[model samples]
Target chain A: MISPDHFQALFDPRGIVVAGASTHPGKFGFVALHNILSCGYRGEVFATNRERAEVLGRPTVADLTEIPHGKADLVFVCTPATSNPEVLRQAASVGIKAAFIASAGYGESGEAGLELQLQLVEIANELNMVIVGPNGQGLVSTPSSLCAQIVAPYPPAGSIGIASQSGNFVSSFMNLSRQSGVGISRAISVGNAAQVGILDMLEYFADDPKTSVGLVYAEGISDGREFANRLEKVCQRMPVVILKGGASGLGARAAASHTGSLATDDRVFEGLCRQVGATRASSVAEAFDIAAAFSTLPAPRGPRLAVVTTVGGWGVLAADAISSTSLELVHLPADLRDTLDGLLPPRWSRNNPIDLAGGETKDTVPAVLDAVVGHEEIDATLVLGMGIQSNQGRLEREGPFYPDHGLERIVAFHDRQDSRYADVALAASIAADKPVLIASELAIGDPNNAAVAAVRATGHYCFASAERAVIAMHRLYERTVWLESFGEPNNERH
Target chain B: MSRTLSESDSKDLLAKYGIPFLPEVLISQADHVEDALVGMTGPYAVKLCGPNISHKSERGLVRLDINGVDAVRQACHELFDEARPEDGATGVLVAPMATGLREFIAGVSVDPVFGPTIVFGVGGVLAEAIADVTVRLAPLRRYDAMDMLGSLRSRSLLETFRGEPAVDLEALADLLCSLSDAAVGIDGLESIDVNPVMIVNGLPVALDALVEFSDVEVEP
Candidate 1:
């Protein structure tokens, strides 16, 4: 168990000290100090440097005791590995409870580095100080408006906790958050994991009120028992999306002749995922996609899903993806199909996808969407008609490209139609407590695209393609189906 | 430093706890083979044993489908005397040959940190290619066993397959529970691999089992 005193201080530090503060730009020390200041941390900042009296417009002290703010709550150590022992010793003497070390060449380098890292952990334990990394990147807590990492794209605040072994993913996830509507609550790159591992941070996130979904990228677990035990507890509350790595080479090794050899460590990890209620994804892209779906939608009641599409081809593609997952699409219900037949034209075919046919009127798409999403038999709905060109009435009037009297006029007319269509889907989704996922060829995977961003802003989701949308729908339902067995949840807070 | 219980002793140990092992008898000499098969019905399986011989099939030390009593005697004599010196055995085991519609593998694998872990899955060559399996930490409850079966990729094997009824879940659960109890109750047990727990009609009977002990010696 982690100490509550250190956990609270490291997360929401009231005072921060930059031990290796530098005036020169682009160095880790300078960027570490710069990020803390730029993110508007409410805590007091103390910069300590030996070469100069001040750095980066803040007065620097040669020693930690010179700070007038008394003992800082947390310290960000950005010095070399050879000098970190002395630096941390001085900080611990000043009653600092937590530290985020953003230096490298400690544990990951080799034998010499490993011994130094062990010594650092020993000092940390003796002083009761929680250290993030001795060879790690930094971390960020949106609740306190703190960004102590040098990674780019400090995303805007939202609910989703990320704990990763590779520090690069921390920055990459931040970039993904910028593209997708889902934002992060906390991000930690647990390098080396001398004391605090992925399971510990996951437990903290499970208890944290600010985070509703967890995204973790792990290479290997040193303690399988602690991992499974902690995972069981964490899964009882919030859902965890895991992306396990390092299996391509290990699977190629020579195998034993025993029948039990069939179950490798990675395969057992998949079993562990089933035993513990966590969703496993094949790639980081899928992990983020799963997190985005969970962050926006409620746990589906079951794996029964429906796909409502304007294009006949998309519905078939989506149906295959649904069946591939743990989900199934029964034939359109009798009563619901009857209602949909009324909304669709006479030319519409009869099927579960309920394709709106090529000659669909504007009313044909929205009417089927509402009826399907509201049906009790359906657990979740995926609507795939958010196209940019000709999706909003190519027949009623000449499209923008027909005659762009002016660029502004063409875009103005397109925006008005886009919002009108978005409102229909959003209102139908909000009308029902069930989740509604949107798909489009044009409005996908880009938050900067106002057409897609506006839909997401309304608490609705838009995926890049029909296949992706269908996959997300299937994952969301499975997470819900898994959580269903853990008894009733508090509510869909996200 | 370590010890290995013979097949007969391991079956005796499991039989005490109500695990469904095939009825078998141990013979110290070839002359005792016929007397041991008095109550048992044909066909019979004859397996030669030695202290160092763990995998009998790979070394061609096992004879199956011996229908008549004379055939059983000839097979047993050849396995013990006609084979190489390494294949010569101090004892032989004879059991009733059992037929089944489905095959399963269940056992205990000792993990360094978590101790014994219970594993259940499909058996035979398909076990590796298909990789349909599930694992639970020892001390499994009724639901854990049931969930273990349901978690397999070929979970349909639990349902009606090829005109055969599903294996009795209650009996399978009881077998797994007993297996778990034995694993947890025993000390210095390295691992146990019970393969081809063949299911006939709806009842399961364990046909073969291999138990290995850890090298670390305990005071007890």
Candidate 2:
């Protein structure tokens, strides 16, 4: 059990010290100091080095005790493995409560390194300090404006908190957050997690006021029952999205029975995930997309989904995608059809997809969205082909026609209309307390598409494909069912 | 070392946990076959039973659909004759042949990571070939058993098929719960394979069972 003070010191430190501060740009010491200062961390910063008097415009001390107060909340250690024990002893003496070991050559190297790792864990226990990693890439706490990692691409601040076993996957999720405009509250790589593991990070995220969803990437679990127990407890409070790595390895035991043969490690993990309510993603992209949905959307009330598309094919694709998931495509109720009838042209396909069939005016899409998303029978809505107008506007701007042909006004109108449609659909979803997923090929094909931009402006992702939208909706519906099974009210449907 | 128990002993241990099994009697000699068949009805399935004989059907040590006293005596004699010296043949098990439209499998296995897991799936000779099973860690809650049954790919087979009533899932869930209890409560228990749990009328009956024990010392 991690205490609140230790958790706070690790993430929201009042002051941080760089124990191995260096003048060379290539060393981790330099980069660690550079990131903390550059990321606008709202805390006091100190540095310590054996030779250098000053580094990165901060005065350095030979030892932590030389500082005025002999204290700092956290220490980012960029020194070698052999120097960590003494550094930790000094930090403990000075009242530092947490340390992020940004050094390697421990635990992943060999027998000697494993011994050193054990020694570090022993010292951490004696000191009662929360240690993040001995060979990890680093971490980012966006709420503190602290990007203390050794990597680039600090994500915008939002509701998703990520903890990964592999450092590169942490970078991968942060990159996704940058691309999709889905921000992260905190991100950490628990490399060789000797003290503070992925489970501890998840528990912190579950209690974090800034985090609304937890995203995890795990490769191996040492204690399966404890993992399941903690994961289920976290899921009860907030949705958890997990992507398990190294799943193909079968159990090595020479089984003497059929049940033994069938109980592979991966299959058992899958069962554990099902028993708990954690949404297991098949890929990194899927995990981020699901986490983005969980962070942005309200909990759907039921499995019933309504697909509203600008074109027939996308709607048909979404309907086909829904067949394999637990979500249902209900027939449009008469009142819903009548309401859409007043909004769409007479040539529209009056069905569940509510295909506009090229009959939508500037006001048609938003009005149709309002009617479909606000219907009592619809638990969720998927609006497809949202960027068609913006895509057309781009084509017109690049064509032979000039501004002399009134092209500028027409393009502006198209862009404004697409943005408005995006805004209206999102508002309707929130007003009705249901998930509204917008999908368009232009989201990926044209990065500047107005609808996608508008959706991202509000920190939500516009799924690149209708199928992806369906997958996200299916995950949301599963979360709702899981919550209902426990007789717990859904995540306050915001 | 670990060893697998004979089918009769396995059934006896599991039966104590409230797992339903077909009524059968063990006949040690050919002279005892008539008395063992007194209350039981034939056509009967008679199989050679011992601590060493784990797979009876694969070795052709079983005789099924045998009717009348003479046929039962002849079947028991043949099974006893087929038993090798190393097989440590103890007796022959005689039970009325069970018929059902659908067959299901349920059992328990101790996972290396998550110990004592319960398995439920389609059963019969094709159980391994079909490879349709769902597992839950024990001891199972009633809902976990129900979820296991509902999650099988062959779940539709549990519904009414060929005029047979839909399997009484509540009863099956209870059976699974009992199996889970046995998994958790039994000492030295390693694995259990209750194959071909025949759905008779609407209830599941364990027709064949195999239980393996771990860390048991072999007698000199």
Best by TM-score: 2
Per-residue alpha-carbon lDDT of candidate 2 for residues A1-494, written as tens digits (9 for 90 to 100): 45989989988988899889899888889898999999899898989999856888777989777665634799999998999999998899888999999899999998899999999999999999989898998889998998888888789888899999998999999998988898999999999998889989999999999998999999978777888889989998888999999854535642556677776677677777777889989999889889999999998888889988878998998999998787999899999998888888898998988798999886788788888889999889999888888788998988899465899998998899989989999999888888999888777788789999999897778888889989988988877877777777676442
Candidate 1 per-residue lDDT, tens place, A1-494, comes to: 36777877788888888888888887888888899999889888888888755677878888666765444878898888888777777887777888888888877899999999999999888888899887778888999999988666677677789999988988877877877667889988888887787887888888888888898998866667778879978977788889898752232311211433644566667767766778888877788888878777766766677887767888888888876667778677899989977877777767778777765664666677788888889877887766553333342244545444464455556555556666776676667777778777565433444457567677555777877877777767655655555566435546
Model 2 stretches astray by more than 4 angstroms: A53-59, A247-254, B160-165, B217-220
Worst-scoring 10-residue span by lDDT in model 1 chain A = A248-257
Candidates' chain A TM-scores:
0.90, 0.97
The TM-score of chain B in candidate 1 is 0.91
Model 2, C-alpha of A297: deviation from truth (Å): 1.2
Give the clashing pairs for model 2. Answer: none
Where does the lowest 10-residue lDDT sum fall in candidate 2 chain A? A247-256
Local error of candidate 2 at B217, Å? Answer: 6.2
lDDT of 2 by residue, B110-201 (tens): 87777778888787778778888898888877767887886788888989999999999999999999999999888877788888799999
Say what the interface RMSD of candidate 2 is: 2.0
